[model samples]
Target: MTGPRSARSGFSLVELIVILALSTIVMGGLTSVLVRQQRFYRGTADLIETRSQIRQAAGIIPSDLRGVSTAGGDIIAISDTSMLFRATIGQALACAPVPLANRIDIPPLTLANKNTLASFSMTPGLGDTVFVYHDGATEAAGDDVWVPYGITGAPTMSSVSCGDLIGSADLTTPRYSFPLASPLRADVTPGTPLRFVRRTRYTLFTASDGAWYLGYCSPDCAGSTPQPIAGPFLSGAGGTAGVAFTFRKADGAITAIPDSVAEVSIVVRGRTRGIVDMGGYKNTQVGDSLRFSVAIRNRK
Candidate 1:
């Protein structure tokens, strides 16, 4: 006779396997959804960062671009690396909250020589860059750097001196150079500039006749060189490929002189970093690019 039937409370191997398989399928679907959501968030974040960075630049460049002291080349002769940078100075009276009955005259400013040192920071090229072709080639060209000396109190203001040039890498160092002018993308309303503004601008021309390209630099000269300073400021790789500056005629309004780059543009190309296929991990990485442009103000 068989022993009393054992009251078993255990799942068979097949049942266990079935349960595990079903659980795994459900989990897998949940994981896929989660991963997709994460990716979406990441992409959105990246896009936001890109826009923010470019916009920051835009906020500053305009004032300085309109202030450019010189402008040459035909209407559309700029390229990726270089464009005309004009400088204008709003005198304390002109820029002051108080309205002036007479026109206020602002003096011109200058960036000091590279060797001198004191408080301000210095880039590699003394606020200058080698204007090159899109191929990253730099041939003999005009001085890519131009320091303007216009604006309020500048004429009588002390010239940029050894004391003005900071030796440290970071601009905020105790001896940081002045922010003489706002970058060419910011405020259009003319006003009094900060006392510690820069006095130089740089242009990089990657192409000759014309093509899309980026143009960025400190509103006024600061560091010893533009290379080290502007290089980092440029669009980081996997980000925008170029920042284009544009010069356009404002509607029917025409200046006896040609109206040029009242604004600059920021263009970018973003790329995908990476992600897993079915594993829900960072395995299969890919890349793509995104682009953006902004017409930064050149004055005020």
Candidate 2:
């Protein structure tokens, strides 16, 4: 009925097969490139994280250790991987002394103008230690010393006139009264300086996920959960410690006694979270190690 059917204007079966084969090959190549790109990005992320962890450890650990005084009984315990010490957390001047009542009052921690002389990194609490500087000059020349006392209970905030130690404008400023485990010495008078300390420990510990981390324990480490400050570092395996602590004397000799330690060397080794491609079927975990020495500022 239509004057010889026109020839179909469509690809032949062989042409269709060839085009499909080419498309499949192109798609396969693209898929390969995408996968490689994804792997590269992931590997980069892991490396960055590893480096960040190492930096965190380097920054935080040194600051804490530098404040410790090896000769002053601040170092409670030390080992290859851990160290416990009394960390100074704050400094204040005694505004008033109630030695017989086993109490001492200091200027308010927070002032309206923020001009208060007392500064605390942490709130004073039970089990904290206070180092009161005794003006041995009050008794005899060259007899000055610091006396340590333990805090026994919660501190109370009360409005107390600090007299000349605080400005008259801040006369109504509240103060904190801390109860001590024992009575202060009779010589401890108003305006005496005080050092607040807390027991702190730093250690290398394995987390639940089988990764190593730098752990921070406050007050004490025994039976207390450590806060992870850094790492997924290299495990102490194959003759390498995850975290290593070396104590040195002033003359650079190794020391076992805490009081003899004048410097501390810290070595932290970090590793990538997963294996990274090194090209040509080679994949390995990237790692870095950092070593730094910290001079104990209060060692003398």
Candidate 3:
């Protein structure tokens, strides 16, 4: 039958074994490459996250500290890990003389469609403090200061027209009357400026996950819970601190007195939430840190 079909050609056993071995080697190399690439991408992501944490801490702290005044007692208290200060929330102009009563009036803070005669960053609320700029009668520079008054009750809307006092034609705009804890100085008259403030605190606090974070507490941190602003930062251990504050005087010397602090040095260290494989190391955590200083405003 066709000369015995010439030994039907096919791969021998040895040839099949060689082919399988080569395929296995190639697949192993490819898997190794894929593993390395995945590790690289993950490590890069962790590094970026760590840097973002540091930036978040940097953004809020400096801006808040820059608004504080050392000589004005804006820095209520300070320690290595925390600072309590008066944070300015809003500002407005007095439309009329402050009477010897427990109330003060500000011009229309918000007007519909019309130009606002007086504006506040936020509406004044109860328990907030207001600082009224006082121009002493004697014209002495030393005697001129900002007098503090506490708001006792909610602000009420009044139909009182501040157009005559503020020299604006918008008489229909209503005024906001804030009740005070006590009578203010009678000398606080028209054209005087006012600032609203709240006692705010910044501190490094431990979160529910057992990680440290930068926290912000307003009106004081004594009984109020702090809001986490940034971080799963490095834990404070072995002489390393997650956050530290150093107060410096004008001469650059460190000071413990809050009144003498002209500059504040802040150091924050951030850590990744998960372990990263990097540079042949496995299960390592990535970290980043930032150090900056802010000079207090209106430091006398």
* Candidate whose TM-score is highest: 2
Query: Given candidate 1, what's the lDDT at residue 239?
Result: 34
lDDT of 3: 0.80
Best of the candidates, lDDT: 2
What is the C-alpha lDDT profile of model 1 across 102-210, one tens digit per residue?
1121212222234321211332123322111121124544433222322222122222222222323322222222222222222212322321123344353233323
What CA RMSD would candidate 3 show?
A: 3.1
C-alpha RMSD by candidate, in order? 15.5, 2.3, 3.1
Give one digit per residue, the lDDT tens place, for model 2 in 1-300: 669777899999999999999999999999999998988888888888999899999999887776787767899888888889898888998876754778778987766666757888888799999999888656674578888999998899866556577766677867888889999989877788999899999988888888889999887778977888999887766556778899999999988888888999999998887988745424888878899999987675
RMSD of 1: 15.5
Q: Which ranges in model 3 have alpha carbons more than 4 Å from their true place? A: 1-16, 111-123, 164-169, 278-283
What TM-score, over all chains together, does every model reach? 0.41, 0.92, 0.85
lDDT of 3 by residue, 1-300 (tens): 366556768899999999999999999999999997898788888789889888888888887676677767888889888898888877777767545778777877665545554665566687789898999778778878888899987898765545455444446666888888888787876667888877889988888888888889877778876798888777756445788888999999998898999999999988777778878557788777899989987795
Q: Report every candidate's CA lDDT.
A: 0.35, 0.84, 0.80
Q: How high a TM-score does candidate 3 get?
A: 0.85
- Report the lDDT of model 2 for residue 36: 86
> Of the candidates numbered 2 and 3, which has the greater TM-score value?
2
